[model samples]
Target: MDDAIRKAEILIEALGYIHAFRHRQVVIKLGGSAMEEPAALRSTLQSILFLAAVGLRPVLVHGGGKPIDRAMTAANLPTKKVLGRRYTDEATLAIVAKVLREDINDSIVRQMRELGGRAVSLHTGSTQALFGERLKLKGPDGELVDLGNVGEVNKIDGDLISSFTDAGLIPVLPCLAYDAHGNWLNVNADTAAAAVAGFLKAAKLILLTDTPGILRDRQDPKTLISSLNEAESRKLIAEGIIDSGMIPKVEACFDCLRSGVEQTHVIDGRLRYSLLLEIFTKSGIGTEIRL
Candidate 1:
């Protein structure tokens, strides 16, 4: 087959997905070591822009935990985490705010704009889209761990986000939220994206992370499970196969699915155009969880 003809074939194959998802919404949670590599990050963002350009509404929610850690290290502040969730005190919240709101959020918007895609920063702390109280986490001994200034999603401004997506603008939402008392709180990006997807009842919640989706065997890449339903996913969690940090991610998928999102996808961000492949092709590269 000629290369040009092969390219056309690819597009023809993608046409089915384009038709199905046209004018629908996909909430993307971008995270992990993928963000540290400039090439991979650029490619992922370009894929998102392509989705937006092709008439799909995309809401981007991101976390800059690595950069926040660097900032803390520079400031001589001790970094800590309980159960893989950051412990954000007042001082740490400031670093989180700066890294998420000022740095990462603006940079994503600028990148999207530079690529000819219009994106608006909708940081919950700034946009008043999310309001929450402090989050109390549990330890192994069943003790409540006080992670000050860290919040779980209590409320989200669905209408406000809708107005932006409805107007054809990509919203770049960060993990920083605000409490009722107007205090800033650091929300986990995975849960944040899940909450946003559930609020909009989005068609798909796509999470781009470091691993090869959900692997049946942690050591083998070939053990990647391409698809799983809600029950199977929950069973993985219950069996401790999806323990640790991955637990939150899979739980977020379950949350979105239960809230009417048709599917949740976990794709490897290291691969170029992975999002496009996962969404458009018949056999996707990652694990897709459906109802």
Candidate 2:
């Protein structure tokens, strides 16, 4: 009886959030260890399905770095990184496209269906919702460094994505976009998700990563910062607390916030139902960045 009562109380706690977020779009960027672990990925997908079932429009964007690496190895290609970003040559881009579209994207859609949720794949090989130009980086010496097939998201098909969400289907997009010349470009998943959120003017953008939000001490999970504003987030970045891979994620949040997204969250996707806890619970289990 006590266990049942506690479950009912949990539902009551979530009621307000459900009502508030109904029909509001929420963009989720899913990657990191969660994608590699069966249980974590299952739980995260279930949470997303729950959100859709309750009337919140959820769009999923994913990155498959580990699988891509494995595919590259099988094809005897060397994996390269420049400034913590993948340096995609033609060969690498081919492998990336195959792994992300044929393997990861299709698998996610299939899983969602198996789990009794409707999902559709939107990538270069399909609906091609994202479009961008090739990306170039600068070295410390101010020299233009070419990251061959890499690109940044320039535009998203808001109407098409909206159509899917409006019809009670989740659109699963792999972090690959098409250039104006009809070439496929490798885009950072975090940036792609942010662009989608910004274009749709989503209510919130949630990045599901491996870490337990942003921690003051990188080595300690207990030091997580539950909430911070844009200024504070920038300060943390300058202080070196938020460095490397985390910088892009934080910047993605900044982009979404600037585009009028109400809030952005970085949470540990490895935790079961972390998405639900972050969105529905009063004391969220992640770091929320607001303007």
Candidate 3:
């Protein structure tokens, strides 16, 4: 009886949140070790389906870096990184496309269906919801550095995405987009999810990663920052507290905030039901960046 009462209390705690978020969109970016573990991935998908079941629309954008790397190795292609971003040449781009579209995206959609959720793949082969142009970068010497086949998102097909959500279906997208010249480009999944959130004016943007949000001490999990503002986040970046892969994730949050999204969160995806806890609980288990 005690355990049953506890379960009822949990539902009562979440009731207000469920009502508030009903019919509102939430964009989730899935990556890191969360995707590598089968059990964790299924748990995360179940949480997403729970969100959908309660009437909140959810959109998922995924990254397949580990899988892509393995695929490239099998193809005998040398993987290159330029300034923390993948330098995708023709061969590398082909493998990336294949892995993202055929493997990762399909697997996610199929798994969601098996979990009793309605999901549709929105990629270059499908509705092609995301579009962008080639991305160019610069080296330390201020000279142009070519990152072939990599691109940044510029436009999103919000209407098409809305159509899917309206029909009570979740839209799953890969980190691949088409350019105006009909070329496929590799995009960073974090930024891709942020762009989608911005275009849809989503109520929340959640990035599920390996770490326990942003910490003052990288080695200490207890030092996690529960809430952050834009100015403080930039100060931390300038102070070198936020660096490397985390920099892009923080910047993605800033982009979502600037575009009028209410809040953005970075949480530990490896934790079971972290998604539900972050959204439904009063004391969320992640760092929330708000304007």
Candidate 1 regions exceeding 4 Å error are: 124-126
Instruction: Kindly list the per-residue Cα lDDT of model 2 for residues 197-241, writing each as its tens digit.
Output: 999999999999999999999899999999998889899989999
Supply the global lDDT for candidate 2.
0.94
Write model 3 residue lDDT over 1-291, tens digit each, in one string. Answer: 999999999999999999999999999999988899998899999999999999999999999999999999998888899988999988899999999999999999999999999999998645999999888888899988889999999999999999999899999999999999878999999999999999999999999999989999999999999999888989999999888999999989989889988889999999999999999999999999886
**lDDT scores for all predictions?**
0.88, 0.94, 0.94
Model 2: clashing residue pairs?
none
Tens-digit lDDT track of model 1 for 92-161: 9888899888888898899889988888988754466877788898789999988888898888888888
lDDT of 3: 0.94
Tell me the deviation in Å of residue 275 in model 3. 0.4
Error of 2 at 256 (Å): 1.1
RMSD to the true structure for each prediction, in A, is 1.6, 1.0, 1.0
TM-score, one value per model: 0.95, 0.98, 0.98
CA error at residue 161 for candidate 2, angstroms = 0.3
When 1 and 2 are scored with lDDT, the better candidate is 2
